[model samples]
Target: MSWQQTTLGEIADIVSGSTPKSSVPRYWDGAVAWATPTDLSRLDGKHLYKTDRTITEAGLNECSARLLPPGSVLFSSRAPIGLVAINTTPMATNQGFKSFVPRPELNADYLYWWLRANRRQLEDLGNGATFKEVSKAIVSRVKFPLPPLTEQRRIAAILDKADAILRKREQALTLADDFLRSVFLEMFGDPGENPMNWDREPLSLQAEVKIGFPFKSAEYVEEGIRLCRGANTMPDRLEWSDTRYWPVSDAARFAEYALVSGDIILALDRPWISSGLKVAEVVQADLPALLVQRVARIRSSVPAEKPFVFQCLRHPSFWSYCNPTETTIPHISPVELKNYPMIKPPRELVAAFGMIAAKQSVLRQKVEQDAKDARQLFQSLSQRAFAGDL
Candidate 1:
């Protein structure tokens, strides 16, 4: 099939967003869905139907921002850029986006996926002294080969089905997350209230909080032992993507940094974000991994203590303890992390809760495996669809 090579500006009107005055009370909180890069970053779906904050009519009138119609593709332009989403309803955005209002010839879903596929290239085009930003002009100049209008819609439809599958898998994973949280809550009576009046203690008292080895980039090897960094810590589990390795010879020197099964790990930096938890317990499969810097390993005093502490960190109530400072990179230092309070129940109670947790975890693992299979299918379909092979 033949494709048309064209710049984005040729197919859509690129509009920049602007923020209304924050100090004006009249301009704040109204019916208008006003978005920001932050909002787009947290979006789990392809379409943005509502925003965390709304604006008044006066806010719309007072600023240069336009009321984007449905089907407009919103793309973040600054402060960690290249997040893309489509507006399902009429909306407005802060100055952090350069939105594309698709023309009659273009399908918004097609444009959304195209932008996502080329996000790395788009992000690389950004330039600024303070923080990277891809200007409206830069965005408009992005050229790509497009199929005919009918083909665009057809391709989008195929991709949408694949995307829907991915979304369902994501929903399943989220449900699994919710199930774990629910189990914790039911067994442990809110950690915030400590209703059981369990003994309050510093995390350091019950665990060996050891920071990872500060290995330089030069220390990385092609293959030897897996190194778990801050990025590897996911919500209640470890993620193996972007796994780095260190020389086996150095293993003796960094033996203390080694992780064993059931060790609870936490990302000392940016521990909490709009995304879920940055803490997890090391599973058996993730054994023999070395803890890299900015990640902390919490070796429980006893095997039973592992599940208790891991669940505590996973609790929503623990978010208040992980402070996001005013600095450019938010982090909780090892000193501060050690001081995090935990309510400890009796050994017998914790052991019983751990049994229930093991059963629930088995269910979660099955759902996760299904999600993994679905994700792989979606990724394969997405590649074929984009390559005109769908």
Candidate 2:
């Protein structure tokens, strides 16, 4: 079968949205969901359950922002391009979005998947001196290869199944994280309670905590060391791609601060945003890597006890203690981290918690592996489908 290339305008109609006047009380709050690009980052799938802010019917009438029906593909065109989500609810978005309402003959899921696969092409079309943006005319003119409606639906179904499997694994990982947090809270009581009933120990006594080396941005290379930053530390994973690198000399200078077999790296800045800590084990070939200035190195005194500290840092009680006083950034300084109190249980009980954490870690590893496999499978399918080999 031969594939025909067509512009987005031939497949769908592009619509822009506007915000209602803020001064009008009736326009400020209502039942309509008002979305921004920031909201797209948190979604698990095409459907969006809620938004940070909502608007009233009066607001909808006051602005160009009209209610987008279910299945409309929403793309962030300004600030950043190609962040896409299909509207599951009757919603209106900010100016940052350029929504595409697909023609009835075209499948919405197919359009969403196709656009996502061709995101780089859309990004390349962005034109602006100050801020990169995809104008309606530019978006409408970008071409894409399309398959028959049935084949499009089939390809979408395959991709959807793969995505669903990955999402389930992610959900399982989230549950395991919650379980670890619960274990920490149960082991250590509320902060207000006296430390007499529990063991009290300084972090210095429990682990080898070290500050990261300060390497200037000019020292960054294309590829050398796996440099970690505040943004690299995520909830359950460390994003290593698109990372800045360090020179061999600076990497050697920061070698001592390099992550060891059982070190937990915690971001001192913006700790509250992610409860900012990531506990990662150093795998083979990860040596000579250095932590960025915003992060700290935490090595447990005992190898068996490292996971316990990882769990402790994620506890809500820890955040409660850290959030009381505001700093320049939402962070816990090194002094604050060192002085922060912890309700220590008996060593045997701590060991038991570590055992449970270790088990959770194994389960999480399996889930992650499954998710990775699903992603690879989806990528392969996408290539084959687009090439008419599927």
Candidate 3:
């Protein structure tokens, strides 16, 4: 069964956003809540409580951005699109958003989930050479199935509960991550302090760091051996959802760059993100993948050192050493990584930590699988809800 077909503009007030002149000092840090795509991207849930940047009332008046009322659905239109959030407070956004103020019959949460569910469709509507952006006209013209007002609220409530489950699972994974970091600290004091008098050595002695090949985008294939690039790497995790592929026939040419379990991969380009260092250790599941440019693969000289080497890189202090603020581009160089001072714990202690790490890895894998399942469940719910099968 299908609900009434309707365009977004028919049921919502389409609002275009703009930025105030950044050069003016008086325009920033004011009472008005100014938002950008980054603000929406930073949020963990549907409701955005605050913004990273704010504008003065005078500044808001000087630009096209208007303060949207609470419950307005914000959809990021560019700089990587399809970020959706509902504002809990009045917010004004920059041009990257084509936000929607719902009519009395349209539920805000419903719109939020609908946009999220149909992200790929929305992304396909984007157009631009340098970067893709979905224009106000494009977003407003997009059609969706509109259920009755009561049905919308009910659907939103159900999705809300489902999303809460996903969040809880995510929280559990985070706690596991924290536990590993704490374990590292307990076994070996902070490398910055080196309180245990562990003999320090340059990372090159314990690990071989090799940068990746500059794989041309034109040669990318639909399916074959996967290319492991910076985008696939996160702290202690490799996300293969948006993976790129290389031709399997040519895989033998890059045999040296093939990833094996226990290898640590690091992103050399803008390596320091808000989420800590872009580093991950390859597991058995990540095998049969070849390396791509701007990503470094570190293999342990002594297999027992693998766990410690990875923890050293995952540490927050490792990023501090990068001093990203001083550099024009936030990057970690091959030389810097090779020369990184590593605190070498005693072999006995390293073996103990390795044992603990392996056990934790198994537990973390199960939790991660649960998290993946929860996300898929939410996606399925959204699809059925929108398809009127709920």
Say which candidate scores most in TM-score. Answer: 3
- What order do candidates take by lDDT, descending? 3, 1, 2
Q: Model 3, residue 383: displacement in angstroms? A: 1.3
Model 2 scores a TM of 0.87
Instruction: List CA RMSD, all candidates.
Output: 2.8, 3.1, 2.6
In candidate 2, which residue pairs get closer than 3 Å at backbone N, Cα or C atoms, i.e. clash?
A: none
Greater TM-score among 2 and 3 belongs to: 3
Candidate 1: worst-modelled 10 consecutive residues by lDDT: 268-277
Candidate 2 local lDDT, residue 62: 90
Relative to the unseen true structure, what is the C-alpha lDDT of residue 234 in candidate 3, on a scale of 0 to 100? 87
Query: Candidate 2: where is the Cα deviation over 4 Å?
Result: 49-52, 120-132, 190-199, 247-253, 272-288, 324-331
Clashing pairs in 1: none
Backbone steric clashes in candidate 1, count: 0
Task: Record all residue pairs in model 3 with backbone atoms less than 3 Å apart, i.e. clashing.
Answer: none
Give residue 335's lDDT in candidate 3 (0 to 100).
87
